[model samples]
Structure formats: C-alpha cells, structure tokens
Target: MVKRTALYVTLVAGAFVSVFPYLLVALTALKTPRQLSGTEPWEPGLPPTFANLDRVMHSGFAGYLGNTLLMTAALTAGQLVFTTFAAYAFARLRFRGRDVLFWLYVATMMVPSAVTMIPLFLIMRELHLVNTWWGLLAPYLLGTPYGIFLMRQFFRALPAGLEDAARIDGAGPLTILLRIVLPLSRPALGTLAIITVISSWNNFMWPLIITSGDDTRVVTVGIAGLKGSIGVDPNQMTAAALIALVPMVAVFVAFQRYIVRSVVLTGLK
Candidate 1:
C-alpha cells in the first residue's frame, strides 16, 4: 500500500512538472499586456483575450503553418516508403556484406547533426537547392539512418515462420514483403510516421539556414521570428507557440496507441 501510494504521488508530480510550462504558455497567450505585467501575471483572465491569436493569424504564421504541414507530410511519407524497403532488405535479405554495410550506416547515427550542418548547407548551395522547396525537403526526404535502424529492429522482431511459409508457396521477396510482413508492422510504421511528422514539423536549424526568406520558412522558424527588435511580447510569442504546439498534441492523441505498442513489442526479438 505504501509503495503504490508513493508511485502514484511520483507520477502525479512528474505529470505536473511536464505540463506546467505548457499551461503557463496557455495562460500567457490569453492575457493582455496589463494582465501579463500585473503581479498576478500567471492568473487566467475572467474572459481570455483573442487579440494575440488574431495578430498571429494575420502575421504570415498561416503560411508558415501550411509549409510545415506540407513538408511534414511529404517527409513522413517518403521516410515510411524508403525505410520500410531498406529495413526489410536488411532484416531478411542475405546479400553479401549486408551486415557490414548495415553496421557502417548505423554507425553514422553516433555523429551529431551539428557536426554535419555546415557540410550539408554547402552541398545544398552547390546544387543550387538553397532557398527552394527542394532544398527544404531534400536532406530528409530520403530517410535517416535512425529511421532505417528503427524499422529494421521491428522487422527482425517479426516471426520468421510466416515468411518461410509464404516463400514455400512460391511468393517472391517483394510479394512476401508487401503481402505478409508489412501488414504485421502497423505499429512500427505508425510510430515511425508520427516520429517523422514531429521531427519534420519542429525542424529549425536546417530550415533556418537553408532558406533565406519567408517563402520556404516552416513553423519553428516562423515562431522564432515572432520576436521584435525592441522586445518580445509575452502574449504574442506564447500564442504563436501554442498554435505550433496544437498539431503535435493532436498527432500524439491520435497515434498514441501505436507508440505504446511499438515500445512494448520492439527490441526483444
């Protein structure tokens, strides 16, 4: 009884700690400047204001949101396709040097993104992809080492007996992969899609450096631009942040079961 009570207390405390900042941001977004500057600044107003939201909607944030949505959708779809195939090949195919090659690719995951940022930027510049939609999507649309590794892990966890049975019935590799393996991988696929969407949606540094203007700016970069030369408005900045946060929350709510299933099933087989 005592241990269970302690566990519940700890969980409640952790949830509060995690949610407090977002709750503060929500309250700030609803406040007017006077309310924001008041002694009870964090308190919710009697009737929350929408001025910050209205301002943000008119301030090119809508365009940024659109760009983020498009980029995230494309990036997620492309990653799912590429990673599925690559991971399947790695997990099932018996090509020579396959293990060696997979390990070599996975090894690249150890290197931080910061270390490769400049090199990637230069390559984009050389290809004249900078400041274009292609530049925005090119780097990640092909998928990541991490994505391939993740899908491979889940693929390897699948029962081999089913695949062997399919093969005995004269099913080719592609046919077996499409008809048998993929249907069983819904949880892993959903988890990867959500991860890719969230990652692409919140990507900042690559989008910031690769694109020079608002034409290609995503939500994260747009939110950063909400700052003013003189000072930042607590209400407007928080409002923009809240707007950016909504889609991610919705995604988690929708696919949360897949995430839970993947965590439970992966890395054991």
Candidate 2:
C-alpha cells in the first residue's frame, strides 16, 4: 500500500511538472500586451482573449501552417514506406553481406547532423534544390537510420511462423509483407508516423537554411520570423507558439493507444 501510494504521488508530481510550463504559456497568450510587459510574469492579470491569435493568424501564419502540414505529411509518408521496406528486408530476408550493410547504416547514426550539414548544403546547391520543399524534405525522405532501426526491431519481434504460413499458401514476399506483417505492425507504424510528423513539423535549422522564401517556409522558421517582427510582444509570440503546438497535441491524443502499445512492445524486447 505504501509503495503504491508513493508511486501515485510520483506520477502526479511528474504530470504537474510536465504541464506547468504549458499552463504558463497558455496564461501568457491570454494576457494583453500591457499585462505581459508588466513586472509579474506569473500572475494572471486579465481574462483570456483571442486578439493575439487573431494577430498571428493575420500575419501570414495560415500560409506557414499550410506549408508545415504539407511538408510533415509528405516526409512522414515517405519515411514510413521506405523505412518499413528496408527494415523488413533487414529483419527477414537473407542477403549477401546483409549484416555488414545494416551495421554500416547504423554506423551513420553515430555521425552528428552538424558534421554533414555543409556537404548536404553543397549537394543541394548543386542540384538546385535549395529554397524548395524538395530541399527541406530531401534528407528525411531518404529514410532515417533511427526509423529503420526501430522498425527493424519491431519486425524482428514478430513471429516468423506467419511469414512461413503465408509462403506455404503460395503468397509472394510483397503479398505477405502487405497483408500480414504490415497489418500486425500497425502500432509500431503509428508510432513511427507520429514521431516523423512531429520531428518534421518542428524542424528548424535545416528548413531555415534551405528555404529562402515564402513559397517554402515551414512553421518553425515562420515562428522565428514572427519573433523578429513582433520583438517584445510576448502575448503574440505565446499565442503563435500555442498555435504551433495544437496539431502535434491533437496527433498525440489521436494515437495515444498506438503510442503506448509501441513503447510497451519496444521495451519488452
């Protein structure tokens, strides 16, 4: 009883800690410019208003949001399709030097993104891909090592009996993968999709560098522009930040079950 009570207390405390900053941001977004600029940053001074949201939306935020959504959706889909196939091949198929190839792919993950930034930029420039959505998504759409690794782990956990049974029934490799493995691996796939969307949506550095104009600007870079334009308008910035967070929060809520299942499965093996 004591242990259970202590565990509950810890969980509640952790939840509070996680939620407090968002609460502060919510309160600040509701404040007037004057209230936000005043000395007490924590104190709620007025009733919530939608003025800040209105201001942000009017300031080209709609375009940015659209661009972000498109980029995230495309990147997530591309990552899942490519990574799933690659992971399935690595996990199930026998090939020449397969282990060596997979290890080499995993080794690439050890190299930090910063190390490859200049080379990637040069390649993009050469291909005239800079300042385009293609440029922004090029690196991610190629299938991330981490995504491949995670999918491979999940696929490895699956029973080979299903694949064997499908083969005995004259199902081809692609048929088995599509009808059997993918259907059973929905939880892992959902988790990957969520992670990919979140990462691509919130991507800042690469997009900031690659996309030079309004035609390709994503939300994170657009938010930075908003910060620069508004300068000291904390209310506006807070509202914009909240707007940026909504989609990801909605996604998490929608896929909460799959996300939990994925984590539990991953932990088990």
Best model number under TM-score: 1
Per-residue alpha-carbon lDDT of candidate 2 for residues 100-182, written as tens digits (9 for 90 to 100): 99989989999988898889999999999999878888999979988898899999999999999999999998999999999
Across residues 47-83, which tens digit of lDDT does each residue of candidate 1 receive? 7899999999899999999999999999999999988
Candidate 1 overall lDDT versus native: 0.89
What CA root-mean-square deviation does each model show from the true structure? Answer: 1.5, 2.0
Candidate 2 collision pairs: none
In angstroms, the error of model 2 at 125 is 0.7
List residue ranges in candidate 1 displaced over 4 A.
none
lDDT of 1 at 244: 94
